[model samples]
Target: MEESNFTEKDISTVETSILSSVEASTVIIISVTWFDTRLQSIQWFGEMIMLIFITGLSIGENKVADKGKC
Candidate 1:
Protein backbone atom coordinates (compact mmCIF):
# COMPACT_ATOMS: atom_id res chain seq x y z
CA MET A 1 0.00 0.00 0.00
CA GLU A 2 1.15 3.52 -0.76
CA GLU A 3 0.89 6.42 1.65
CA SER A 4 -0.75 9.66 0.58
CA ASN A 5 0.57 13.03 1.65
CA PHE A 6 -1.58 16.00 2.66
CA THR A 7 -0.37 19.55 2.40
CA GLU A 8 -1.43 22.76 4.13
CA LYS A 9 -4.02 23.40 1.47
CA ASP A 10 -5.54 20.01 2.09
CA ILE A 11 -5.80 20.64 5.82
CA SER A 12 -7.33 24.04 5.24
CA THR A 13 -9.90 22.52 2.93
CA VAL A 14 -10.79 19.92 5.53
CA GLU A 15 -11.12 22.53 8.27
CA THR A 16 -13.33 24.67 6.08
CA SER A 17 -15.54 21.70 5.26
CA ILE A 18 -15.89 20.78 8.93
CA LEU A 19 -16.70 24.34 9.94
CA SER A 20 -19.27 24.67 7.20
CA SER A 21 -20.92 21.44 8.24
CA VAL A 22 -21.09 22.54 11.86
CA GLU A 23 -22.59 25.88 10.91
CA ALA A 24 -25.16 24.28 8.66
CA SER A 25 -26.14 21.75 11.30
CA THR A 26 -26.49 24.43 13.92
CA VAL A 27 -28.69 26.53 11.70
CA ILE A 28 -30.91 23.61 10.85
CA ILE A 29 -31.23 22.55 14.48
CA ILE A 30 -32.13 26.06 15.61
CA SER A 31 -34.65 26.52 12.85
CA VAL A 32 -36.34 23.26 13.63
CA THR A 33 -36.43 24.01 17.32
CA TRP A 34 -37.80 27.47 16.69
CA PHE A 35 -40.77 26.01 14.91
CA ASP A 36 -41.22 23.26 17.43
CA THR A 37 -41.19 24.75 20.89
CA ARG A 38 -41.08 21.40 22.59
CA LEU A 39 -37.51 20.82 21.45
CA GLN A 40 -36.29 24.37 21.85
CA SER A 41 -34.39 23.92 25.10
CA ILE A 42 -32.69 20.73 24.04
CA GLN A 43 -31.76 22.13 20.67
CA TRP A 44 -30.45 25.32 22.17
CA PHE A 45 -28.20 23.42 24.57
CA GLY A 46 -27.01 21.15 21.84
CA GLU A 47 -26.21 24.11 19.63
CA MET A 48 -24.26 25.74 22.41
CA ILE A 49 -22.16 22.62 22.95
CA MET A 50 -21.59 22.19 19.27
CA LEU A 51 -20.58 25.83 18.89
CA ILE A 52 -18.00 25.49 21.64
CA PHE A 53 -16.52 22.38 20.07
CA ILE A 54 -16.45 23.96 16.65
CA THR A 55 -14.88 27.13 17.97
CA GLY A 56 -12.14 25.13 19.68
CA LEU A 57 -11.47 23.16 16.53
CA SER A 58 -11.38 26.34 14.48
CA ILE A 59 -8.91 27.95 16.85
CA GLY A 60 -6.66 24.92 16.77
CA GLU A 61 -6.81 24.84 13.01
CA ASN A 62 -5.90 28.51 12.83
CA LYS A 63 -2.91 27.91 15.06
CA VAL A 64 -1.77 25.09 12.86
CA ALA A 65 -2.22 27.26 9.80
CA ASP A 66 -0.24 30.06 11.40
CA LYS A 67 2.62 27.63 12.00
CA GLY A 68 2.55 26.79 8.26
CA LYS A 69 1.67 23.23 9.14
CA CYS A 70 -1.99 23.63 8.17
Candidate 2:
Protein backbone atom coordinates (compact mmCIF):
# COMPACT_ATOMS: atom_id res chain seq x y z
CA MET A 1 0.00 0.00 0.00
CA GLU A 2 1.13 3.58 -0.65
CA GLU A 3 0.66 6.63 1.49
CA SER A 4 -1.48 9.59 0.37
CA ASN A 5 0.14 13.01 -0.03
CA PHE A 6 -2.63 15.56 0.46
CA THR A 7 -1.56 18.88 1.96
CA GLU A 8 -3.58 21.11 4.28
CA LYS A 9 -3.90 23.76 1.58
CA ASP A 10 -5.31 21.28 -0.91
CA ILE A 11 -7.89 20.03 1.56
CA SER A 12 -8.87 23.55 2.49
CA THR A 13 -9.36 24.52 -1.15
CA VAL A 14 -11.58 21.49 -1.81
CA GLU A 15 -13.63 22.13 1.33
CA THR A 16 -14.19 25.77 0.43
CA SER A 17 -15.27 24.92 -3.11
CA ILE A 18 -17.74 22.30 -1.86
CA LEU A 19 -19.23 24.58 0.79
CA SER A 20 -19.69 27.43 -1.67
CA SER A 21 -21.40 25.15 -4.19
CA VAL A 22 -23.80 23.83 -1.56
CA GLU A 23 -24.62 27.32 -0.25
CA ALA A 24 -25.39 28.59 -3.74
CA SER A 25 -27.55 25.54 -4.50
CA THR A 26 -29.55 26.05 -1.31
CA VAL A 27 -30.24 29.68 -2.18
CA ILE A 28 -31.34 28.73 -5.69
CA ILE A 29 -33.66 25.99 -4.40
CA ILE A 30 -35.28 28.39 -1.97
CA SER A 31 -35.75 31.06 -4.61
CA VAL A 32 -37.29 28.58 -7.04
CA THR A 33 -39.71 27.26 -4.43
CA TRP A 34 -40.75 30.76 -3.44
CA PHE A 35 -41.53 31.69 -7.00
CA ASP A 36 -43.31 28.41 -7.69
CA THR A 37 -45.59 28.95 -4.70
CA ARG A 38 -46.52 32.40 -5.95
CA LEU A 39 -47.41 31.07 -9.40
CA GLN A 40 -49.79 28.50 -7.84
CA SER A 41 -50.46 26.86 -11.20
CA ILE A 42 -46.89 25.55 -11.36
CA GLN A 43 -46.58 24.37 -7.78
CA TRP A 44 -45.38 20.93 -8.88
CA PHE A 45 -42.56 22.57 -10.81
CA GLY A 46 -40.72 23.21 -7.57
CA GLU A 47 -40.26 19.48 -7.01
CA MET A 48 -38.85 19.05 -10.51
CA ILE A 49 -36.43 21.92 -9.99
CA MET A 50 -35.30 20.44 -6.69
CA LEU A 51 -34.70 17.04 -8.34
CA ILE A 52 -32.66 18.57 -11.16
CA PHE A 53 -30.50 20.55 -8.76
CA ILE A 54 -29.83 17.56 -6.55
CA THR A 55 -28.81 15.40 -9.52
CA GLY A 56 -26.50 18.12 -10.85
CA LEU A 57 -24.93 18.55 -7.43
CA SER A 58 -24.14 14.86 -7.16
CA ILE A 59 -22.52 14.75 -10.62
CA GLY A 60 -20.51 17.89 -9.84
CA GLU A 61 -19.24 16.48 -6.53
CA ASN A 62 -18.15 13.30 -8.28
CA LYS A 63 -16.12 15.27 -10.82
CA VAL A 64 -14.55 17.32 -8.05
CA ALA A 65 -13.60 14.16 -6.17
CA ASP A 66 -12.01 12.68 -9.29
CA LYS A 67 -9.93 15.81 -9.81
CA GLY A 68 -8.72 15.75 -6.20
CA LYS A 69 -7.39 12.20 -6.66
CA CYS A 70 -4.90 13.40 -9.28
Candidate 3:
Protein backbone atom coordinates (compact mmCIF):
# COMPACT_ATOMS: atom_id res chain seq x y z
CA MET A 1 0.00 0.00 0.00
CA GLU A 2 1.11 3.55 -0.66
CA GLU A 3 2.12 5.49 2.40
CA SER A 4 0.22 8.60 3.45
CA ASN A 5 2.16 11.79 4.05
CA PHE A 6 -0.41 13.29 6.40
CA THR A 7 1.14 14.11 9.76
CA GLU A 8 -0.57 14.59 13.11
CA LYS A 9 -0.21 18.34 12.79
CA ASP A 10 -1.86 18.28 9.37
CA ILE A 11 -4.80 16.30 10.69
CA SER A 12 -5.15 18.65 13.65
CA THR A 13 -5.11 21.66 11.35
CA VAL A 14 -7.85 20.20 9.14
CA GLU A 15 -9.97 19.31 12.15
CA THR A 16 -9.55 22.79 13.57
CA SER A 17 -10.55 24.35 10.26
CA ILE A 18 -13.62 22.17 9.96
CA LEU A 19 -14.65 22.89 13.54
CA SER A 20 -14.25 26.61 13.02
CA SER A 21 -16.38 26.51 9.88
CA VAL A 22 -19.07 24.55 11.68
CA GLU A 23 -19.11 26.99 14.57
CA ALA A 24 -19.24 30.02 12.30
CA SER A 25 -22.06 28.54 10.23
CA THR A 26 -24.02 27.71 13.37
CA VAL A 27 -23.70 31.27 14.62
CA ILE A 28 -24.77 32.72 11.29
CA ILE A 29 -27.76 30.42 11.16
CA ILE A 30 -28.87 31.38 14.65
CA SER A 31 -28.40 35.08 13.98
CA VAL A 32 -30.39 34.98 10.76
CA THR A 33 -33.29 33.03 12.23
CA TRP A 34 -33.43 35.05 15.41
CA PHE A 35 -33.04 38.55 14.00
CA ASP A 36 -34.93 38.34 10.70
CA THR A 37 -38.09 36.35 10.94
CA ARG A 38 -39.48 37.90 7.77
CA LEU A 39 -36.85 36.42 5.51
CA GLN A 40 -38.19 32.89 5.65
CA SER A 41 -36.80 31.83 2.29
CA ILE A 42 -33.41 33.30 3.06
CA GLN A 43 -33.36 31.54 6.39
CA TRP A 44 -34.26 28.23 4.80
CA PHE A 45 -31.60 28.69 2.15
CA GLY A 46 -28.99 29.53 4.75
CA GLU A 47 -29.91 26.50 6.80
CA MET A 48 -29.72 24.26 3.75
CA ILE A 49 -26.35 25.65 2.81
CA MET A 50 -25.09 25.14 6.32
CA LEU A 51 -26.28 21.55 6.35
CA ILE A 52 -24.56 20.81 3.05
CA PHE A 53 -21.38 22.50 4.22
CA ILE A 54 -21.37 20.54 7.44
CA THR A 55 -21.99 17.28 5.59
CA GLY A 56 -19.11 17.95 3.22
CA LEU A 57 -16.87 18.84 6.14
CA SER A 58 -17.82 15.65 7.94
CA ILE A 59 -17.01 13.54 4.89
CA GLY A 60 -13.67 15.29 4.47
CA GLU A 61 -12.88 14.90 8.16
CA ASN A 62 -13.59 11.19 7.98
CA LYS A 63 -11.29 10.80 4.98
CA VAL A 64 -8.51 12.66 6.78
CA ALA A 65 -8.92 10.55 9.88
CA ASP A 66 -8.85 7.39 7.81
CA LYS A 67 -5.63 8.48 6.17
CA GLY A 68 -4.09 9.13 9.57
CA LYS A 69 -5.12 5.68 10.68
CA CYS A 70 -3.09 4.12 7.91
Give each model's whole-structure lDDT.
Answer: 0.72, 0.65, 0.74
Candidate 2 clashing pairs?
A: none
lDDT of 1 by residue, 3-50 (tens): 779545445665776778687776676766777635567866876777
Better of 1 and 2 by lDDT: 1
Where model 1 places Cα greater than 4 Å from the true spot, the runs are 1-20, 23-38
Clashes of each: 0, 0, 0
TM-score of 3: 0.48
lDDT of 3 by residue, 1-70 (tens): 9989976644566567678777877777677688863547877687678678778878998898899999
* Model 2, global lDDT: 0.65
Worst 10 residues of 1 by lDDT: 6-15
List where candidate 3 sits over 4 angstroms from the true fold.
1-36
- Highest lDDT among the candidates is held by which one? 3
- Tell me the lDDT of candidate 1: 0.72
TM-score of 2: 0.42
Best by TM-score: 1
Error of 3 at 26 (Å): 5.1
